[model samples]
Target: MTPAAPETIAPGVLRLTAPNPGPMTGPGTNSYVVGTGPCVIVDPGVDDDTHLEALVAAAPGAIEAVLVTHAHPDHTGGARRLAARLGVPVRGCDLALAQPYDPDHRVDAPLADGDVLDLGAVTLETVHTPGHAADHLCFFAREARLLLAGDTVMADVTVVILPPDGSMSDYLASIARLQAMPIDAIAPGHGRRLDEPAATLAHIVAHREQREAQVRDALAAGPTTARAIAARLYPDLDPRLTGMAATQVEAHLIRLAENGEAARDGESWRAGN
Candidate 1:
């Protein structure tokens, strides 16, 4: 699919929305080009050839570096290919920590939470927000007061927190961390840009809290499996999304267990001390 022309979203930021749209990825993944003369590309989107060419064409200057918010396929799939094409390095979190563990998902330069990528016009600071994915990172353009929030915060959908790699507690902490920052707008991984950072973050937190309450209540009834709890809570859920719902339920249960509010019994969860 052909990507629309790059739109200038900020002072020196151009947004190129890829063409791999779906229920999870609303209007496809957003790839941002920051700065001029020597630009920095963030989240290269999918591995489609057309999208790769679009990314290259979107940049007004030489592509300095390809920055990945995480190693998720939808975000980092075309990162290496794009970097290789431009002879630039792909920088992101340690690949060893990435989910679905792909050895081919290369990161030439590993970025830490406090690391900064100076792009002359603006500096994009890394903010490690692990919840939706273990290696998720959000880029904060302090000068613009715009956060390049990957899957950590979406414009229209709640991020899925799948356990084993994702944690509800960690997600909340990440949200709080962002809340403490002076952000004016959020360039999320999906959908339109969020202008109300404070209200958006608060709403996300409140929704999670409400869902956790529902999860806790579901558990209090009796020891049950994550799938069972999801079935009880999401009666009108689409069959295709049942698994995702169950995974989210398990993540919530894991957080509850961590807080000593719930206990795990083999494959089931029950109320605890």
Candidate 2:
């Protein structure tokens, strides 16, 4: 049975919810369909028959391609299955990571910065905004000035910065790139539509900056660890979230150390004066 169709965000764009939901989460992962004819599906979301059917039903007829923003399972789980059902090819970054999604399906196209995808009359421009994940990308509607931001810019919690694949430096640069664009609306991957795009972007930037400052302050208090910084910065947060916070804190610390704003002595950290 097909899952219920997602709410309409624009004239032809629809946002479908994935089946997977983790702890400390609101709503669920979002899969978007842009255009009605020869539609483009973004982030097919987790592997679920219901969700896949819902997505197919939402955009009947031709499904030109399935586009993934990142390789995260929550985002690309259904790419292979959906693409096969629609007889179209999957397109995205990190094809290796996406291989496990479906054995038969291949990444037909590589998504990069400034690539324009025609979805009927509407055109979606691909903006490579890595950080949440190295392969992360966002789609911008030039005519509507709307951004279908993947996990890179969610309305709920800030996207995680997993090392090796994730970089704080790249994430900040991506945010700045988005800020430089003419975005009026943000259709996030996991939350309600954001009308004031500029204000929302500002708030996200300010929040990250404040967290960086807090990390510096924690380092200044004497030799401290990422866990210590997280504790100091989020005293009231749940203990389970401390680990995630520490990861973020560590990302900031690493970035600061690279810039000479902070340094590590042995096993402890200290901020430069």
Query: Which candidate number has the best TM-score?
Result: 1
Off by over 4 Å in 2: 95-106, 265-267
Estimate candidate 1's alpha-carbon lDDT, on a 0 to 1 scale.
0.88
> TM-score per candidate, in order?
0.96, 0.91
Task: Provide the overall lDDT of each model, using Cα atoms, as 2-decimal numbers.
Answer: 0.88, 0.80
After TM-score superposition, the amount by which residue 39's alpha carbon in candidate 2 deviates from its true location, in angstroms, is 0.6
What is candidate 1's lDDT per residue for 1-273, written digit by digit as tens?
A: 656789888877889888889978989999999977688889988888887888788787888889988877889888988898899899898836625744578788889999987777878899999888788899998789999999999987889998778889999999999999999999999989999999999999999999999999988888889999999889999899999999999999999888899998888889987
TM-score for model 1?
A: 0.96
lDDT of 2 at 244: 82
Instruction: Kindly list the per-residue Cα lDDT of model 2 for residues 57-86, writing each as its tens digit.
Output: 888447899998877777778888888887
Candidate topping lDDT: 1
lDDT of model 1, residue 160: 90
Q: List the residue pairs that clash in candidate 2.
A: none
